[model samples]
Target: MSADPAAPRLSASGAHFSVWAPEASHVWLCLFDADDRETRMPMTRGEGGVWHSEATGVGAGARYGYRADGPYDPAAGLWFDPDKLLLDPYATAIDRAFIYDSALAAPRGEGGDTAPMIPKGVVEAPLAPLSGALPCFRPGGLIYELHVRGFTMLHPDVPEAQRGTIAALAHPAVIAHLQRLHVSAIELMPINAWIDERHLGPLGLTNYWGYNPVNWFALDPRLAPGGIAELRETVAALHAAGIGVMLDMVYNHDGESDAEGPTLSLRGLNARDYFRHAANGQLINDTGTGNAIACNQPMVRRLILDSLRYFVTQARVDGFRFDLAPALGRMADGFDRRSPLLEEMRADPILADRVMIAEPWDIGPGGYQLGHFGDNWLEWNDRYRDDMRRFWRGDSGMLGAMATRLAGSSDIFSGAMTRTVNFLAAHDGFTLADVTSYEQRHNHANGEENRDGHGENLSWNNGVEGPSDDPAVQAARRRDHIALLATLFCSRGTIMLTAGDEFGRTQQGNNNAYAQDNAIGWVDWAGRDTALEAEAFALAALRAGNADLRGAAILRDADVAWLDESGAPLSVAQWEDPQRRRFALHYRGSGLAICVNGDGEACKFLLEGQAVNVAARSVRVIPPAR
Candidate 1:
């Protein structure tokens, strides 16, 4: 079940329970009945800090938890409390979703038994490993990132009972929509079991993004009522439709915050080895979530690797995008490309071929390790997002930068093939529509006094801030949207588009809507722009039809040419001109070319003996001459 073989495994006799609590004075396996009563079974200490116990009649669907009693010294990071019921790190299912309470975080002796408040790990017999299934997604394909709850919550066709659940994704309407966009994969934001932040309860808010995960293997009951089975079925459905599934995993930190946080699972078992700490005995705040996972530790690495293997073999997911990925590659020496955990994942037979993308940054020291992830990894390129935004905003001297990004940011990635995942907007920042309508983040609703999100969004208001009734302003915004989408599809390497961005979804200027689990966070299906959606579909088709646009390799000198309006090769002066906006890229022998007009007025570009009229603030895919 694990490196130390600690997770509950079913046996012919009954069920076997084990856990690793190195310094605990005593540990008890807490078994609960249908009426919520608990039975304590003492465990025997074994080699390597493992505690083992056998239940003669325990079987699948039985709810259980662990209680480790030991030194409760906060300074030393030994947070063991028998009163706090701890979850199993390898649990595949849970009886209920976690709801935070002040008592859960109360001091070791001050708190009462949390058995009723905490969720118990439900014993589940493992499903047979999915065989003969390979990932359906390839790099340089469209990755549609969406929150499972937010994406399906407002869908009119989805049944009321299925809304906001993983099963809803398998509904015909959702699958049809993904097929329309030619989505290569659906990158689901964290679906693992998570808990609300401590401060969120007071403000009547919750962590809508599911970044604060509590257990790695358990599916949050709020999203997946059927647990791992639901996920497996949905994945099978997506695979049947030729779509892949990618999970946004949060291994950097757990929902357990600082010293004052609850002793849910890892903290109660072994916080000293599970989480990173400074020499002064304080938790390291690398993830900005009050604690950073000690991924460098042997046992912690084993647990993470086991979780990945479980998802791949059981759920048949395509790959993973690591949130705050620097933590996984971090050690006492800081972020390293050759970190042990990273190496193991790349070399592991189960995970070696899976797509591994990185957020590539954290708030830790030397945390931004963008292009340093080495080969076999794709990174979320903020440079592509920022540069593309700046260029379309008509910022001077942005032509060169935009060209570089469109060509897959070869400067940042020095490999033969680029590993950049070019994207305009993702789950963290402003939606595509908000990027053109809001000049600043309106996050007052986040309860952070409007100071929570990114300050400089590289965004422009297009002559009007927020929603505008002015016809000209609205028209300009639409044009900008089309132009931005065309640039993305025409770019090299893998590309990601947020779920609602194609149809003009907005957060009402609230860039940081992580706390808004209501209407603000849900995708507005009724209000989507049909024309813009059609435009995105056409762009996807165009990208799919052309090899040059989908190719990951950088364009060679012989294959592509940067030309002026007159169709001649561009000179250094023209390339360096800060005011230059109009340019054409001609791919020799491909019968396909692209013309970009960044100015506010339309212009004509001479291409292959014909003058092509290009609209202002737009990009045109010029066809070959007949």
Candidate 2:
């Protein structure tokens, strides 16, 4: 579906590269030797804004880069300094570790050659067609999101050498954990090659969240010790185990921060055309990052589609979750659900059946298109997150909103056509444990003076802040933890749980642990709660075995009944009661009644002829006639 693709096409004799750089009068394909010696060969220019070249004896594992000589004007957004060894936009593998160097920061002046300072792309062979069929990780299935590094960094069962690597995620222990939760897919946080923000090194922090992407196709060396092969192997293992792999992609923008950021890939080649700049040539900031990509451009769109197809055909990933996804739907006038990019992806034969999840918002004007995505695209439901948090926190008049959320958030995602990926916490926010342990975000460790993360987290401390030693506070937090997980599993539509949240994991109340790549961010397997783990398994089993809960259609009046403490359907007066934190939802024919009592004291609910007592701040899933 791409206009021009397969940039580096491998041939029988050698590898051929076709780059799009119309403005450049000349472009050099630079290859490096084992001693890091450079070999420069000029590429011939052709019509349609393409540059082509082929080199013999250069197939797989060959290190290469490109230098385009055109114009250099920051104000005009030219950014064409040939001194920088720009990474190939279509690079599939990269060599060496990425250390944040100040020299790589801004184009302050015509910087010297950066070949010795930065990593270069590796020439890799094309992937063969998979022997088996793709995994059927349907859109509405339960998804477990996790970070490769954080999930395995502190996992004692994984070998030390494989820890934090793509290979580590395939360990038997990790597989068992996902199986226990009955997760259909694992939406891995961005494992693509990324850069640590220039401000992090000076602040003694690291870019642990992986949002600041540098190379679109290559895997980050730190996270992929064995590169693309390891990723493919890991995904195959997951597929064999009946679990799907979904990648969190960041195509909305690049790591080239601002005019003052790194000249890594797109920025160095042709900033004026590759990036969206104002009339005065100022970079657009739609992504909240320094520069928003001009994806409407044919070449940029080609790059995105090519990278996507590569992963599907090569790595065998089941799907993708686009971060800050609104940027993908932006046209000249505004965001369009039928934008060329969105239409192209949907029409593509390879991507149509695969799962596509959109974050569905950006920092640009008219950007929050929550429920505005086209058909077949599932979206992250922030409304569900807020309502669930508020209701469980004992907020007044939250019962009505909670009812809507419980029914797959039909108020927003009305279509039984597309499902919602409902989650209480993700990588960018407080972990489930932190949600009940801290009222406010404690991100002082992020070097931003506790001012980095979301201010209004809708979280409660139970009775004390941070870690609690008091038995009462500890007991209450543990109960609320189970209650939140229960609500997620019981809610209609697909649910997502962050890794390590099953047995209680905390980031010390730091909602924005994007820069805290230490023990605070890693999962502590040694300290997991065994009892809570069993409870999580039971909850998963409950959701999996219920046909009504996993139905493909939106539930309406006859399908659901909102009952009061008397076991009868609630009246208008009772629905409006300020103290109606206690309620029950009897899913028709599911034979399960999910009762919640958010009060500070125990409450009794009439279940059929018997009055069953449920403890306060707890959620109980009862079977009919039990």
Candidate 3:
């Protein structure tokens, strides 16, 4: 386990606040009143670079900030300004949302005091023990990825007051929708409090994705009306419904950008220790968010682990999906799978049983650590996404790759037990409907022209781009969409479906809709799209009813036979053939034969010694002659 830096302990009498600022000459605790007035008191410096202070009047519900008097040197990566108020790195709750201003990020000479404008931290009362038994999340369970606001913001059945709040999602109508798909877990995308990026002001956009975080521990007020209590109630409700919750967490970077970025919390408290920097003190742009968090540091590791365990014990969350997890495992040497933070999470007494998922890649050097997260950790397989896309889009020479992903990507994740969290669409990319209905990403609304999203989406338009009135093209898009989702569910390991992808949700070809908070990003519940919804339920039912598909252990070669159209396992020469796209997969134990045609035209397959013709860009599921 990493060294415990358990400072800022709270008690009934008052709060014990301790900060690690070795360079500071003096430090003061600034307690704020309801009227926005601050009562400043000097803090004494302790051993090991920690400054400690305890105030009898300051307790839970008190709003406070910090003032550290240290050298104003940016060249050495120290930017301590007494006039600028800083947030506690261990703060449990924040008073309000972060409102970014240009003056907050400027150098001391160029900028003035931001305390008046910056949000203050609020000390929260300790949480009560959870009421009811929680659902246990494990491999092979279905995950429904959603955004709290967008998931219920426009939900017709949800009350207007509850719209866009955590409680809104726990409504019976919303839970029924989740229950319809048998979602064993819900992966909420970043409910943590975050500040809008400075660049978005001019474009009149907001950080709808909640990736740019200012407070790691506070829940976004917009998403949680009653704050942490509201979230706990929601989780308890979901647990009662037999569904677990997994939070999508961002520890890779802070809302603070490069040198010109805001001081916010950690950056203002201790920039050098909180974030990664080169030998010359320049910030490392690993997360592409300006500054990458130095998770290798003991203090930062404590922050992450402490926050995780807090959610488990206080909020009763089942697991977490770490965003750009490579940043957490990075070191001065390079990316290490056995880094202290990773080891701590794996061995932590509280976190060991929790479901740990990794995004698996970052923008740093050797950042792509897919299939390298050791054991007991599942990964979002980009290989599954790409191969499934290429094969279904009628791209030739991909049959072998497609076969590998369907069988749990043994070529990549070959540790015996399946750790692949396979999905055709997630929150970050194009929807399953859009992937087959559009060729190019139309991200004009992002205000970055059309250069914002991924260039190569490996998508197909099915003879028409974006929304098409052509019935033939629409039918083809629907066919491809259902097939892609079916493929995802039929694959080994766990399967995740985006909230509206099952019902043919479209972002109008906008792959990266992170900034758009309007109707463009919200799920379309008005249009029921019953056909695609049924396909989703069919896939869920297929996984639940078929033991072979959701095998506890990795399916052995004898369990499945990847056969050619002639109803026989493909020969070495046939498997290598680029023109080979039509194949029948037979689950030997389950007596299920599925014929997948990836060709541009329909193909005939001999199933159970009986000839059957399958359409192009489609999948045919049949009982093996009963």
Most TM-score-accurate candidate: 1
Report the C-alpha displacement of residue 206, candidate 2, in angstroms: 1.7
Q: Rate the local accuracy (lDDT) of all candidates.
A: 0.91, 0.84, 0.84
Error of 1 at 490 (Å): 0.6
lDDT of 3 by residue, 539-623 (tens): 8887777766665366668778888888888998888888888787888776687788887788888867788888887877776
Candidates by TM-score, descending order: 1, 2, 3
Weakest ten-residue segment in model 3 by summed lDDT? 1-10
Candidate 2 Cα outliers beyond 4 Å, as residue runs: 1-7, 106-109, 131-134, 624-626
lDDT of 3 at 91: 75
lDDT tens per residue, model 2, 1-626:
12243456777898887677778778899999999999999988876667788888787888999988888778888877777788888888899756677677546454577888879888887677553465558655789999999999988889998999889989999898888888899999999999888889999888998999988889999999788889999998888789999999998888888877888878877788788888877998998779998877877887888788878888888899999998898887889888888898999987777889999889987799998886788889888899899998889999888887877777787655437878999998999989989999988998888888799999999879999789998888889999999888887777888998889998999999999889989988899877788888999988888766655466687877888888999999988887788888887775578888888789888877678788888888887554
Summing lDDT over every window of 10 consecutive residues in candidate 1, give the lowest-scoring window: 1-10
Return the TM-score for candidate 2, rounded to 2 decimals.
Answer: 0.97
TM-score, candidate number 1: 0.99
Error of 2 at 51 (Å): 1.0
Comparing candidate 2 with candidate 3, which one achieves the higher TM-score? 2
Q: Write the per-residue lDDT of candidate 1 for residues 37-86, one digit (tens) a residue.
A: 89999988888898888899999999999999999888989888889999
* Candidate 2 lDDT score at position 550: 56
Question: Listing every candidate in turn, what is its Cα RMSD in Å to the true structure after a full C-alpha superposition?
Answer: 1.1, 1.9, 2.2
